[model samples]
Target: MADERATTVAGNDAEDLSFALSCLAAGAITPEELKGWIQLALEQSRELPARVFELFAPGLANALVPGWRGLIGTWPGTSLSAAEGRAVAGIAHARFPELQPGGAGAPDRAAASAALRESPAIRDRFARVFPSIRVPDEGEAGVGCADAAESGAGAEPDPAPIWWLAGAEDSPLAPANAQRIFDDRRTAGDLTTMLESDAGSTLVLVTNRARVMIMLTGLGGESGHATDPLADGLSGGFLLDNGQEDEYRDRDTVALPRALAVIDHILTHSAPPAQGWSVEVEG
Candidate 1:
């Protein structure tokens, strides 16, 4: 079963790579654009995309060199669009010309839904890591915190936990802040301590316009001011920061779920070791 899951993940990666390549070939995306996607994939699982390519498609792996290195640095831009999603699927189909047809070229909504059906491993891992947030599906309406508050007028409201790093000052987890978090060992250690101290606390980080709620399960005992803390046991998603208005006009609906999946993957597969800490999304 483990082997089967590995194979399935590899196949899914191939589809993703093929889709990326297809998008590149179709002139719908540039290499830089593809790199952004690869970066997001890496954040989800350090071993992936590269590992998938190295194991199954070594030739393509070599092709993605230095540009793929970008994944190690800072967070890139937003998630792909529905049209881009279709292009990714299309490219996957094109790569494996021998695969069955009809489901290859277009983005299948069912596939997205199926992917959301959490696997037992993912569910168990999430349960162990931290409390889970019930995020609304894309395009759902009136589910924001304000709406929830209004609806529960007569009852004691059950608000979700909102954790933030001290001195974060409600700043968005933009590229600059992410870089700082990655670079400052003192800050990283402090954050790690905070995460370790609170099991249910969700550390809120922000991108330029999105809010990333991260939950950390463990921060290994290594004491030195290392460069990247929270290396493992980090998973997050983009959701409306509760009570904050939609501040960014150009919002990408897909970013949060994608970020969440990446965090979950890191927690499940690359948990921090007991003696030494490891950072998953350093670059």
Candidate 2:
């Protein structure tokens, strides 16, 4: 039974998952985009709502690189339209030529996932691969998205909250408390608490608690310093050399993209702030 779920539509390396998560956590990929990737995968694969795509699409899309949209994009809603089915089949026909209908390795969806399609204990299959990752219930059949409601044909799933912030080991963002911030926009209460308030009042060391990164968008003392993050890449956030993981940062001026990529490559844990990471406002 355990051997049954090795459905390798894509790779599942730990470092790869960690990198994708780091980008998501470090403000490289907005949560909106991560949600977009999940919606795209779920749209086509009704067999989704399965954790494989629900929690794993961000990594899958990043890993797949270019062929992702064609591979995962599907019309959303109660039914898979005939045209939509053909579109998916067309993709499989092109990419995995031997794995489509009338080919050498063709296996219908029903045959491929018969074991998981209705099983109540679906979470059990992915536990070893992704510990600490939350698993959704084995939802009702034809349920649209694992995290959001159904949308119209060819539509996208509504965005869902995900990617927990690493508060402190002791105060790790509990599932319930995590949602309170919604996006990265941090509260004054958070700033005062996290930074002990020392910098310019200009660079308030907004802590990571900000909604998205400021990324040097308006790097000036005049207008936008207080709300800015310490990191200087887009959507803005900071990085630290925790001394545990091997570092992969870019030192040159053309840095943001590389910095983000570094975050993806360097972050092995993929969740929470690092240890000995006492918050401080860098002036």
Candidate 3:
């Protein structure tokens, strides 16, 4: 965490954040301590770090935890929200890199390679579709023709090829409409349909990245409130006394500890496993 941080909109100011970061740097506050503070800041305000907090604490945490970080996310979405869990942890851990439970980050080569080996499946997928891929006669307008994109008689090809052959010009799409990946015997056809669907299906990629992702998700309810997991003290976060009451009572002494439950919820459930990658969260 730098001494000079970009300003934040979550009511917490740069000065407070910078002080928290400084305390974090000086070991006055542990990683978990700093995380407790950030989670409080995130939950009460229900802000996305993207739209709100910008700094990655303790200065540069990893090269940035990669792949499938979020999808169709919003403030209220934190109800059982996987995106929120990952975001909070990522922001907190980055600021305190010294003792991350993890050491390094990499993909699950065995699983990734296995997925890569299935490239042949792509060809198999196109085999039937290709026969139906009609090239509109050069001069004739075949309005109903299922061209290349429909099966390859158009300007674009399957983008998956470009990712492998040319290497991605950028990373994969994220914060996308949640996707559901169904791994079944229907092979390519089933997958194609699933990929295009609106509802969600879980086929996540897990990496033992130094930046931790709170693996415990979905404990709260879908409606976003009635069964909210953090509903007790956290649902209505408190402001520091800041002499606001003029009673001279120490608000932080009590208010700050409330954040521990959220911190503990994350710590209790998160088990990143070994330092490698896998295709799914280890059940």
Candidate 4:
């Protein structure tokens, strides 16, 4: 028991030092000052020197701690500030060389988000990752609303494609209706039908890679709360501290999280599980 506690303490201390080193490498701190600090930390302690090597040198820590996984949770959709994101990006770049977390300063975020808004690659990934929520059938060549009418196939308006492929086509509460809900501050009449039926809330998840979706029910109730399990099961999520009204807060915090939770539940706890999708292992 004591040995296990000591190992846990050592691991925590290592993470702290790693984060500090990453911050310094990102220029959030001075390299010279960090060098001095690292030297002092190393000289004063027995384990910290090994810890520093574990953090800065790749494959070393994994060798030392068998079956170890780095960090158990992802932040609620890249919630890190520019400085914070840059720090992590720096560390990821140095260590993994393949990962590139997005931020305000990253051109890749804009490009990838835009591409995901239309890309079939994203939709495919979404289906594989979370399958309980129905993925919309892509139209021929995935032409948008402007071209769909010209092609003269389905008269019903389709939901606008976003990052994670949620929402439906020809539902009374279509993409335009969602726009009205966001912009006009009124639920669509068709949406009311779903509410009356006790169906879940319409949910959307947007990431640089894809848009994921699940429905949230009971939005019409007095409590105005709905749930989805997949989203709820996620380790962390974007949250609002100031009653969700602060301009600094992402608006998704209001509608996205609960809807995500419902989706999570459906995907993970639903009977038989969806084919080609598996439950995420608990860390």
Candidate 5:
């Protein structure tokens, strides 16, 4: 039954991808439209990365299109071996030629790994998303002096951090609606309140990636004052503070860690906030 269900899902995804590609080729669909469809396709199938590589291998040039990079760059590392991951990265490098050494995309693995290890912001984000990766020595970097003193004095070790991926698409919610949600004074206040309530809460708003808007949710839900997850008509999911397994669902939920890694890599290698997104960190 599982195999049959998987086959059906794969078939549906293929049809969706084909339709989107045809629409794109015919100029009947905009790049944003095609991107949304691609995201939806990715959300439905875990086999998508390999399938995409196989399908686009014959015409590697198709991956060069801007709309395709988000899918290609954010391909799950678990889905591909190291060699396969590098191969996909190589294709992305070809597409953006700027990713070559000394080009805009030139941050080597060493630098990125080091940033992941040392940068307070990156480390904090990683701790929230992958609690298992957090060790005692390095994890304390983000702790406040008072908190550290308290821990040293007698308090129990802090609880693990919770991380969530918040996302909005142009389909379910239009751009104007998005702007309104972000712009609303009440919503802004609510977000502020959430951040203030939890010292570990962090929010990263992604605006410029096609028609996608993504944010990170950290530990900040007080009693009787939880932030509405669907305020922006966006969907979300989280990596539990206690490090529970996640049944990958939508792109935002499944791709949270990879998305953050991509964002970090881009920020480390590329220029300023030209990608039409801004990140806000609290705590």
Candidate 6:
């Protein structure tokens, strides 16, 4: 059953790639635009995409070199659009002209992967062989424009047991807490300390978008509770509630587009005390 799940994930990833690529080939977005969406999707989906990509990464490596590596980086701290990300998917098509969604390849997949890994010269040759793809010099091609701050302080945030909230409204997690977060946003090293400190506190990290990340831990370890209630309510979409139950839904979901909208609103409505956080905007 686990294997089945893995197979399904891989197929879905291919479909996702196909869709992303089709969007790119249609000229709907520039490479820069695609990078942002790809970044978001990868974070939200976690390791799912990479597992699926194994089905075709070798074939696509020639055309996807720079883009694949760049896309990997965006998942953590950058934004990438789906359309632009299709360039990475197109790499597979470039490598194996006969390969397509639901297509068959070599009899022993592991052997092929082993062969590729064993030969550095063959790998280098493969990259150079594809002239039409235009692999750019690392220094020349750039990522996207948006600049995002690192998630935690150079250290860490006070991870002591506490309450956490989602959204940037004037709820329990209000301007004061927001200010605290902003104050601590100076360096990642500081933030790391906070996350590791408290075993029983609730930590809320808000994105410029309305989305939020919540961490719950306890002295004994961590609280494992029913998150389905919150997920069901928020999954289909629910009103922003300060209700006690809404306090911790275990894990929650916030769509990127909506999250961005929330972030924009926050930026427009309130300015972080300039003294607290370091600001960097990428052009």
| lDDT tens digits by residue: candidate 5, 1-283 | 0111111125333433443343343232334333433443454466554544433232443444444535444322132233332332322222232232334543443343233344444233223322212222223322232234434753553543322223322233232233334335223332210111123444433322221233434322321111212123333332233444233223322132223322232222221112222334445
| All candidates in order of lDDT, best leading | 1, 5, 4, 6, 2, 3
Clash totals in order: 14, 6, 8, 25, 0, 46
- Candidate 1 has an lDDT of 0.32
Tens digits of per-residue lDDT, candidate 6, 219-264, equal 2333221111222333222222232122322234333322222222
Question: Model 3, 225: alpha-carbon shift in Å?
Answer: 23
Clashes of 6: 46
Per-residue alpha-carbon lDDT of candidate 2 for residues 123-196, written as tens digits (9 for 90 to 100): 24233222212222223111223212222333452222222333433443322233233222334334211211
Give the better candidate number (4 or 5) by TM-score.
5
- List the candidates' TM-scores in order: 0.26, 0.21, 0.20, 0.19, 0.22, 0.23
lDDT of 6 at 64: 43
Candidate 6: regions farther than 4 A off: 1-9, 30-33, 43-210, 213-283
Taking every candidate in turn, the Cα RMSD to the unseen true structure, in Å, is: 17.0, 18.3, 23.9, 19.1, 19.4, 19.8
Model 3 alpha-carbon drift over 4 Å, by segment: 1-12, 46-283
* RMSD from true fold, candidate 2: 18.3
* Model 4 lDDT, full chain set: 0.30
Whole-model lDDT values for every prediction: 0.32, 0.28, 0.26, 0.30, 0.31, 0.29
Q: Residue pairs in steric clash, candidate 3? A: 1-58, 1-59, 57-95, 58-95, 108-277, 148-152, 148-153, 180-201
By summed lDDT, which 10 consecutive residues of candidate 5 come out lowest?
Answer: 222-231
Candidate order by TM-score, decreasing, is 1, 6, 5, 2, 3, 4
* Candidate 5 local distance difference test against the native: 0.31
